[model samples]
Target: MRPFLFLGTRAEDLAADGEYDAVLRFSGLAERDLRRVRLERDELPPLDLDDWSGIVLGGGPYNVSDPDDLKSPAQRRAEARLADLAEQVVDADFPFLGACYGIGTLGRLRGGAVDRTFAEPIGAVTVTLTDAGRTDPLTADLPGSFDVFLGHKEAVSALPGGAVLLATAPSCPVQAFRIGTRVYATQFHPELDVDALCTRIEVYRHHGYFEPAAAEAVKAAARTATVTEPTRLLARFVELFARR
Candidate 1:
């Protein structure tokens, strides 16, 4: 089996590693089978889809829907690179799964509306699977409703062109979606646990997902969340694409 490519976009050392570790844990990929790349510090190579089993994109502090002037140089570069990759991935229907930031990047790339109107606070939320989600191979085994961790400043306002809505929450309508059967995106962090959320809350305190004064409360709330179901989506992505 070819190695899976994991792209992460976090500048902070601990935050970046935490994202990678989550993907590694949920996907059940060995160190050798998973090739992790920090997009915040590295250039995106020409993605030859055949060279990798699939691509996994992790959450980040950058928001794609932000105004041009507010975007940093690194964010701009990452967005451009991801847009280019999204085109290729969609055109070829390549195997891919994007979490958090993935929804904004790929959703916007595919002509969907992504905005801050549906932003969710940092915590766990109940997400119900749609009829399509119930039958979709990636989500079929998942419970009809389950909890997942999510914190974002922007979300998909509607389904992207040619995308299927898989799961949804009251806070954000488009919680999870799939494109061309092989490509998937989720607003929630499928790989996160309480410890992981605490780490992120600490690392990203000033990034405005929540007020600094609320950090302790946020961490405490995260501790009480039961979100074991979403990890299955990550494992399912690996199981479906690792050999091909």
Candidate 2:
């Protein structure tokens, strides 16, 4: 079977690897079936969509809506590469699933608004499916409202043209969306479980998702969260697109 590609942007070693492991676990993919790419440490190559079954984008510390003057050199480069790739992916209607940071990237690429208007604090929150979401193959089986791990400084204020809104929350309207029938994006970390959320809370304590003093509280909340439904989306993506 052709392997799926996982593009990640975490610069820290432990956080990066942990994210990869979480993806693999939630997607139910073995190492041999998933090719991981660290966008922080390497440049995106000329991609040929036919070579991989699908693409999965992981969350990162970079906020696409940040001012140009505030963006680090690394963030600039990574964003540029992802912007180019987003065009190709969308034009082809390729199979893609972007989490957190991916939503901001795809939202901006499609000429939609992405800003801090709907920033959510760290921890699990209720995500409710819209009518469209209840019928979409990726979210059809999910409960109408379920808990998901999310913490983002920026969110897709409005979905792009021709995109279908899926899950939503009071704090953030565009919790999930789909472009055409295949490409998907979510403002939450569907790849995270309790342990994974705890790990991220500790690793990103100083990255400004919240006050450092609140890290313990965030981790404690993560430990108690019953976030099983969101992970099913990861498995569903793989099951629907993985090459046989």
Candidate 3:
């Protein structure tokens, strides 16, 4: 295996480290099997699917639902670059696991309607898997319902043409989806756990997932909620994708 590539975009250094550590812990991947690429102050070489076994994307404060006028030039450039990156991932049906923000990036590329209509604040939510999602190779071993960590202001309103809706909650109709055989996306944070999420709530206190004053409450909620089931599913995804 070449390595599992991680692409992250969090302007804050604290947020960046939390994202990186959560992914590594969830995947249970050895350092040799993972290569993280931060897009904030780094340049990405052209994506070559042949050289990498899989790609993973971490969540951030950025939202695809923001209006173009509100986006800075750098943000716009990053979006375009991600689009170009997804082209190869989609065409090759490259093994991919995108959590939160990556869901918007991949969803937009696949013709899914992504907006603020279904935003879930910081907490754990119950999710039911669709029949197709239940049958997906990555999710086959999981139960029909499970707890997942969520903190976002946007979600997929409608799945794309060729996508298989994997999971859903009453608040967010599209919690997860699969593109082709290998590409996958989750609106929730499958890489998050109680302690890890608490760390994030501290770093993202003002990112607007919650009121600046309510950050402590959010952490308390995460501490009491169950979010490990989803993280295990994410680990299984990376493990199985390596077999293809």
TM-score of 1: 0.98
Q: How many pairs of residues in model 2 come into backbone collision?
A: 0
Provide the TM-score for each candidate, comma-separated. 0.98, 0.97, 0.95
Q: Tell me the whole-model lDDT of each prediction, alpha carbons only.
A: 0.90, 0.91, 0.83
Regions of model 1 farther than 4 Å from truth: none
**Candidate 2: which stretches are off by over 4 Å?**
none
Off by over 4 Å in 3: none
Clashing pairs in 1: none
Task: Note the residue pairs that clash in candidate 2.
Answer: none
lDDT of 3 at 122: 90
Give the per-residue lDDT digits (tens) of candidate 3, residues 1-244: 6788898888888778877887788788876788987776677889768778799888887788899998877677777778788778888988888889878888886567888898888998999999987888888777899998888998888787798888889988898898888888998888887887888888888778889899888888778876657878668977787643
Q: Residues 1-244, candidate 1: write the lDDT tens digits.
A: 8999999999999989888887888889987888988888889989789899999999989998889999988889888999999889988989989999889878986568899899989999999999999999999999999999999999998678889999998889899999997988999998898899999999999998899999999999988888889888888898888864
TM-score of 3: 0.95
Superposed Cα RMSD, model 1: 1.0
